[model samples]
Target: MPGRDETDILHSWHRNADAWTRAVREELIESRRLITDQAIVDAVLDNRPRSVLDVGCGEGWLVRALAAHGIQAIGVDAVPALIEHAREGGGSFQVAAYDDLIAGRFSQRVEAVVCNFSLLGEASVERLLAALPSLLEADGRLIVQTVHPLIACGEHAYVDGWRMEAWTGFGAAFPAPAPWYFRTLASWIGLFATSGWQLCELREPLHPQTGRPASVIFVARR
Candidate 1:
């Protein structure tokens, strides 16, 4: 089976823009605001990072939130339509693939890189992680959140497909035909450590309603 391309996912998202946006706002963004925003907000609170780069900023929801907190934020997306939708919300949005990000996009290194539920679909985690240092300031931070590797690989009857679950004895199998890389908590920290990042914090949010773990959140300083 072929790995899913980020572009293909973007195309699909664009095709269902209305429904996608609503789902994002309801299930992912608005509903999980406390879990998502609070974790990121706390990590950046002490540093007061100014300039921000939002990788895979779909629809600019998080970008706008960052701007509201007084951070100068610019969001980049692979989909032009999503970027356009994001731009309409009062922040700068650029149409660029994660693999294509270079120094030219920003005048200087940004103080923080916020990648919320993005980047997992990328074909190369090493290449994706490697790009962080160049995009980050010396004391900058990288805040990332995604479906927990363990849960992401497992079969979830609720979703009508496999979710994060155990496979190969230890690691996780990719949930779909996409390049969904799932790592255990240790593996996750290890990957960041190899790239010269010091782990700052790890938060696993409990669902507001069920109190079950929902997502894995990490804060790393470079």
Candidate 2:
């Protein structure tokens, strides 16, 4: 069972699904417009995988993008509403939580598994890494895009811990704020190594105009 913090994080997404979908699709956020979305897509395409699994895929944007390139992509998310939206967007998607994926609920191992700004906590990272061996084919790759830990740390001291999303600029549409655990860059490297994943490439997606890193992309091999 998820602890209080995990529960809150899940609930926040469930409640704010619609708003998030709109924000992402409409490009209301600067990060998506400048770096996040395209960066993730580029990383996936560079791998040239025949099939990809999009874990925690929200509204299936990445899946749709991948399909445009003629790549087979499957999306899975915990929120039923988001899954429904993803289907409406014309992509294959299923309602599955992180735990469900870890349990091999959705069969068919893929050449690549991509988590786009979806990994939220240390426990989740550990659990997902534990399940990768079974879900990935031989020589499979894992790609992850997340808020740059340095940017996420912001004014706070550099450390690993839980940080509540301010939800600033999102307006009153968001009813609840989402909380994500902050992992330092070093912590991330160590975590992946201990989980039996070899760090292959670490790239920062820079804003087109400002040249500031908006997200960190990690490519690992099993």
Candidate 3:
């Protein structure tokens, strides 16, 4: 199977845009519906940010959610279709790539920058992280939620590498997934340090029924 790469991943998102929009809106994925979604929301809320920049905000779900808490949120994504869908749902959204995220001038620094299961590409994620300090307030936080390394590793080797994602349980509309890179726990911490971030906290939300972690949340500071 081919591994996760930039070209293939973006192409997959473009191809799967419609299906993904429906899936997110309808809560089709069991993990997101049961655990990861609320997990990320709660993590962001914990910081009590007045303004948040949601990186890779697909369909603007998180942006709308944060608005209910009176937090101003701006969502940006590389996919035009996803950004369009997000805007239709009512919130601030922009079409931007990883490079755009690093270079685009915002009106002001935000209190929190959240990446919810979206930092999958290796180089892009690293570069984006390095540039985030400049976009945040003095006490700002960078919140990242990703697949639990142990769980996501499945039967694969326990190292940093790209893997083919299977869009299981998302139904026939999604036969495959975009590129996803797996990072070990140590690797995650190292990435943060090298990207000019200090690891503040790590959270793993569990599946209530099985007690298995649904995803790992990393809260960091510059």
Candidate 4:
């Protein structure tokens, strides 16, 4: 069963779906424009995957982007509103949560599974990692981009724990802020190993203006 934080995180996304879709679509925020978006896209393209599964694909921007490149991509998110928005953009999308995926709700195995800044809690992540083996083709890869533990820590200490998003730039439009677990760089590597994933590559995306690391992208294989 999902814990309190996990449950809240899920609910918060549903509540914030409309606001988030607008923010991401109209603004194309600085971090996304400069770093995360292209980084994830480049990582996927580098693998030349024919089919891709985009987990927690909020608003399906990546799915549409991949489609524009002639790559077939299916996006899944927990919020129906987000999925609806994605469909409106002509992208294939499904309303499914991480638990749904683990329960084998989605049976198609793709060449790549992309989690774009979506893996949140340790328990949920562990379950998702364990389920990946059955969800990917033999030689498929998992591409994950997430908030860098260092940057996410902000003034907080460098440790494995839970952190809440300030949702600062998002303003009052977003009512429920989501909290996510923080795992150190070493912790991330260890989690992959214990979960039966081989960490193939790690990249740190930097803020174009400040030249400071913004997020970390991990490419792994089962």
lDDT per prediction?
0.67, 0.88, 0.89, 0.88
Lowest-scoring 10 consecutive residues by lDDT in candidate 1? 158-167
Which candidate has the highest lDDT of all? 3
* Model 4 TM-score on a 0 to 1 scale: 0.95
Rank order by lDDT, top first?
3, 4, 2, 1
Off by over 4 Å in 1: 1-8, 26-34, 102-107, 156-179
> Per-prediction RMSD in angstroms?
6.6, 2.0, 1.6, 2.0
Candidate 4 lDDT score relative to the true structure: 0.88
lDDT of 1 by residue, 80-162 (tens): 77787777767888887766774345445799988887755434555677767888888898988777665654553322221
TM-score, per-candidate, Cα-based = 0.77, 0.95, 0.95, 0.95
Worst 10 residues of 3 by lDDT: 1-10
Clashes of 2: 0
Question: What is candidate 2's lDDT per residue for 9-32, written digit by digit as tens?
Answer: 788899989988887778788888
Stretches of candidate 3 off by over 4 Å are 1-5
Between which residue pairs do clashes occur in model 1?
A: 151-164, 152-163, 152-164, 153-163, 153-164, 153-165, 154-163, 154-164, 154-165
As a TM-score, model 2 comes out at: 0.95
Model 2 misplaced stretches (Cα beyond 4 Å): 1-4, 170-172
Better of 1 and 2 by TM-score: 2
Tell me which residue pairs clash in candidate 4.
none
In the range 77-110, model 3's lDDT, one tens digit per residue, is: 9999999999899999998888876885555689
